[model samples]
Target: MHIKERLFGKTAGKEVMAITLTNRSGASITAMTYGASLLEWSVPDKAGKFDNITLAFDNLEDYVTHRPFYGATVGRVAGRVAHGSFEIDGDPYQLETNQETNHLHGGNSGLDTKVWDYQTEQDDQEARIIFSYLDAEGSNRYPGNLKIQVTYTFTEDNKWKINYQAETDAPTLFNPTNHVYFNLHGTVSKTILDHQLFVDADRFVELNEQSIPTGRRPDVAGPPFDFRTARLTSQATESTHPQTLQVSGLDHPFVLNHDANRLDVSLYDPQSGRKITMKTSEPVVVIFMHNGASPLKIANNPIPAYAGITLETQDYPDAINQAHFGSIVLRPGETYRSETTYSFHIE
Candidate 1:
């Protein structure tokens, strides 16, 4: 059977209250609409016993008071924008930037900070939840009255389907993605260094220290940034390499090998015999591995300092500013549509 939960604090209006997704193996995935955040996800291990695979805080206090942006939905724009500024139609616009100069995760008050309209339903082992929000013309200092709808469905087959759509009364740029950390071998393990990762990408955008694309799409072959073949991820982070130092791990987007329809990206854990496959209609996907920092720094998790890797699917990081890059602009009367799915299967 499917279950639903609703929580509200007299002071806090419309908390996630409850999530209604089933665990195919009798496990559970508890989500909250608070940040449109994922609070709990239960996945199986080698012993056929399911465990909470992602690292997350237990309560709203932990989420609100301390670490957020972990396992939560980030919006407006997902990655970083150089110098917290961009030019659209030759107009220069600057945002309230973070991380010392870059605009990280939309802005100071991104989509995670807004109150979303919650629509949910359940039947038998299947559950569906939809989160919608309206953005004013200058809410984030961006243009247009934008309406976005995100539908999350938990299937009996153990698939987490995410479908996103948006329409604007005026012209604006849009990019949204879920930032979830995964450790198939369980949390508290040291590095995902040994796990095998395969990305069907032949090229990747190089980034400057600010995490903004340098507008150069380099060949992924022979460089440390290469993941064309299934290889150990840590190889890209050796002592003498470029993909190593900038805040650590794989945080860059891979220009996919397949078209912008459905493509499969896989990660396998030899220790647990578990596998994760990521599918999306988007052309760019960012793979980020947690590098272990204090709770005040990054998102809190129950891992050995650095124990998870994040698979974030989206359009390019800073597309609005880069004309050479793909288009993120949603014009009037045009609807933007995209879908990404994260499915789990056993070996």
Candidate 2:
């Protein structure tokens, strides 16, 4: 195993560092400290060739200027907060409406843009990198001073594990997730429409016109939202189902089974014979097909809709607003923890 670090760039007078972790399987993951974001993930294909499967920029400037989350670690809250307003303890708080009418990914200048402290280590067993960030009190109009820590580990078995821990000094909302867009076809030009996906979910959250959750978990056994069984990605997108037309692609949260250490989702690309098995401790997973408009280009290549797939695991969007969904509130003495693992293999 090998771990290396280099000066990536400077953000807000702070130095950003890129750390690379390589395991015995010749698989590697590169992460930057600027946003505590993943820059690249190289895995072996069936042909024994390794290729980066995630969308990445060539420089830090592209990530800073681009609106696409890319491989960012989204925080404060991972998804929307419903009109950017939420009441806690009888007090109303309003957040930045970065996503038009709702608060998206913790508003503008969220944790994804801030510099984080990082530590790296490589042992005979695996290579790991841990990132830590502190959100000051009322930094983003939310109460409490929050401290967050996330660790990324690469094992010899080709498993990538992400562990998150957070605590707050006052009652506040805390939900963080890694927004890593994957293109397992070995290239960004290829769309993931042909990939086979299986999500261990029976119900999915319905969305409104503005992409806000309606606080309903409709059964996914039918309609365009169904993924109860392994199915080709195109089957859902090509249909005229109302939910399918709403986002131009899939972009809703799926309720995950409560079984711990069990597989939550599986994405397989037949073209490259690469498969990814993911397990998470979260209750919901939002799978986005990247159907929105974007001018951001990665590696000098224009990124089009459906170019990548983002499987974000975290608390459901607007959990604070909808008490029935689940509680995302973190009190002063409580600790928040989440873990997600992606095991890579060739089928």
Candidate 3:
């Protein structure tokens, strides 16, 4: 089953806001263009009941107005950069810092503000919503007349396949990803303290006091950072680190088995009978615990702080500033392409 038919509504300036993709197994995923975010992921629960597992809101305005970063398509650079400055072609450039002295989520006017193009193809086992933007050189204070596109597709294989591509006119840095707060428990305030998790990386990025890279790659085998086996999120949260106070949860970058064109991650929630496998074509995975405060907008809503648990599949955060770390540079003839697939199954 896939998008059987797509309809265009009368209002809303001709944007394809609501799209549904049906899996071969009949499971479905929904997406909206307001933030170019995945709105709901409906999969089987423990008792075989279909439930929306992704934490979401009731309407489109919730996405546009919510500062919670609920399900956002982030770009330019997704994570934080110390003082929002990066060196491109041996020139140091500073970006607009929205989060204090730190540049966060690509500054104030990031990708979330733009609307994407959508097409519900008849042959696709999925529906895709695409967003394209042209960033002139030095737009984000980075050197590039960048043309970028981020596509979110829901496949019949039970995968949310997110693909990103960009080509820069000048030498610059680009790290883009979808910042989705995933919880198998379904949007609650409970500490993910007991949720068991695992990863296949041996080393992680060490950070300074402001969540900036210290330029040190540390081993995970002996620390609470190690999640090669099934381990609880609380264990990593309670462990010791040099910059523990800066990032409360697991807000570190893990060096992955690299590829010239891919990045991937696999996560599962046993209690909910949901298994999510993420695959991408990138060098670094910024795994954040979302341990940061929610700044919860709804005053009375019982929803607690949600963990980002994001596998930010891209170059390292603040990569433009670190020479030893790799750069996300693409030449005139080069095309920047990255794909991440999130496949879901019930155990």
On TM-score, the candidate that comes out on top is 2
RMSD of each: 2.8, 1.3, 3.5
What TM-score would each prediction reach against the true structure? 0.90, 0.97, 0.87
Please list the residue runs of candidate 3 whose C-alpha ends up more than 4 Å from where it truly belongs after superposition: 4-16, 136-138, 189-191, 258-264, 293-301, 306-308
Candidate 1: which pairs clash?
5-17, 5-18, 6-17, 7-17, 16-33, 188-303, 188-304
* lDDT leaderboard ranking: 2, 1, 3
Write down the worst ten-residue block by lDDT for model 3.
4-13
Clash number for each model: 7, 0, 11
Q: Clashes in model 2: which pairs?
A: none
lDDT minimum window of 10 residues, candidate 1: 294-303
Q: Which stretches of candidate 2 lie over 4 Å from their true place?
A: 259-262
Q: How does each model score on lDDT? A: 0.75, 0.87, 0.69
User: What is the C-alpha lDDT profile of model 3 across 99-165, one tens digit per residue?
Assistant: 8798988777676655666555545455665666686776656666888887777766777888888
lDDT of 3: 0.69
> Candidate 2's error at 78, in angstroms?
0.9
Candidate 1 structure, TM-score to reference? 0.90
Superposed model 1: Cα runs more than 4 Å off: 8-14, 123-125, 259-263, 296-305
